[model samples]
Target: MQSMEGSNRTLVVTEFIFLGFSGVHRGQSFLFLLFLAIYLFTLVGNGVIFTLIQLDSRLHSPMYFFLSHLAFIDICYSSVTIPKILVNFLRQRHTISYNQCIAQMFFLMIFSATQCALLAAMAYDRYAAICQPLRYAHLMSRSVCVSLATASWTCGLLASTIHTVLSTNLAFCGANRIHHIFCDAPPLLQIACSDTYVNEMALHVASVFVSLGTFLLVVVSYIFILSAILRIRSNTGRHKAFSTCAAHLVVVIIYFGMANVNYNRPSAGYSLEVDTLISTLYCIIIPMLNPLIYSLRNKEVKEALRKVLGGLKKDSGLPQ
Candidate 1:
């Protein structure tokens, strides 16, 4: 956006160029193929899980309802960044229009924030099911689940709106090259021509609220969960209860660890390779790994997938 409404200086930056991996001296084609495969697999994996959840009535519980939304968010979240990454691999100079860059950043923020809150919600769900089994029914009823999900999404959107509004209003002057893979906030702020103190403040506040705050919620829930698990007199029962959250625990570790590394920084650093690698961890790798991670060791998900596959075979008149 360009503006000179009340100032003598002209601020013009209609688009930004991404130097994501353009500095890579070798094998752009290989990079493209690798990520393309990852992207397709990510979509197919999340899509299949999403469809299975929608079609299987057995999976209509509050937990699966949240799982469905998580799958949807993974699909959308990866789509927001991976496509641009793939495109950049084939072009000598990758560029995104001003409006497009802003839109990308907006969605990326929304999904990132929402996923943090959603993980907390899932943790709370697990806590209820395990620590308070007698009242789990009342604690995580349909209405209660809906309320939690709604609150997670509402907080995410509110936080993203505030950050995006603050970011786009900053003057970019003539600087338009983004060093990172995507239109992330830190990289964008690095090139701003105007004062960015207030914007940085808003970013830190939102990061604490969305990222650190939700992470603490998950941590506290897990503490209670661990205490409950330890109290079970039967060792097998204790192991079984802990196993239910094993997958979610793995995801929580990777997701929050990478998110903290990305957003908790004081400013954008100049190591392009390190930046791109970390970005890939959360944006592309985690989303692709989610469905398989959530389903591979889960008896319920495996059985549901088997039933769905069997139905498909019968519908197509293939051998039973």
Candidate 2:
């Protein structure tokens, strides 16, 4: 709806259009299939990890506990954006209601922030295990692991709630089209009718505190871990120590590296095509790759998957 007050024209936008590579009909069809396959694999792969962690008694350790949480977060993080993107891929009317858009933005923030905290918590777990091996069990007690996981979830929820409430309250009496695949803060803020200075500031502050702060902690923990790994006398010992966290390090580098590039920008200002590609890579591509990274690199996860699949085959009386 449009209203003219004096010479000023204002629009009351109740919905947002998602213009995600829709112009390229053949390309859109190909992308839809590709993303569908990727999303399915992501769900199946992470689900296997989550289930194995839950059911396997030998996997009931601090590291596996955090791995389970990370897997759960991957499922959630992908769910927040992938399904909508998929629906938009199949549908002609690529639109989302204002409330739906707000909800998507809120949950996306929660999952992304929570995953950052999870990565940090996992890093600290590795630091304790590698740097302070003697006291590893004592330091990463079950209670401590639970506390860290709880704190991560709480912090993410708190951070996202602040932004979601504030961002949703912004006046959207302007362009109704969101120029990206999903509702992200940067793109959503682009169409805001109200001045977004305060919203942008809040986002920047949150990025600094929650995203950068957690990442710095991860970095520091790794520094100590690397120092400890280097101090190992035997080459085999060093390799073993480093192997314990190689999977996690790979995950952290990919997840946080892309996130920092996307979120820690100068402002919400971004090119639509470039922003969409990068966001898809950050949000969709990374989640799909995490299971592959962890399972392929970590010995424990591979064994657990083997045993789980073997048991399923046995239960079904199927030849393996």
Leading candidate by TM-score: 1
Against the correct fold, how does model 2 do in TM-score?
0.95
- Per-residue lDDT tens digits for candidate 2, residues 1-320, read 55657566666677889876656676667888988898899899899899999998889999999989998988888898888887887878788888898899999899888999999999999999988879998999999999999999998899889889888778877687777888888787777878888888888898888889999999999999999988889999999998999989998988888898888765644676777788889989898898898888877888888898899999999998
Question: How does candidate 2 score on lDDT?
Answer: 0.87
Model 1 stretches astray by more than 4 angstroms: 1-11, 268-270
Model 1's TM-score against the true structure: 0.96
lDDT of 1: 0.88
Alpha-carbon RMSD, candidate 2:
2.0
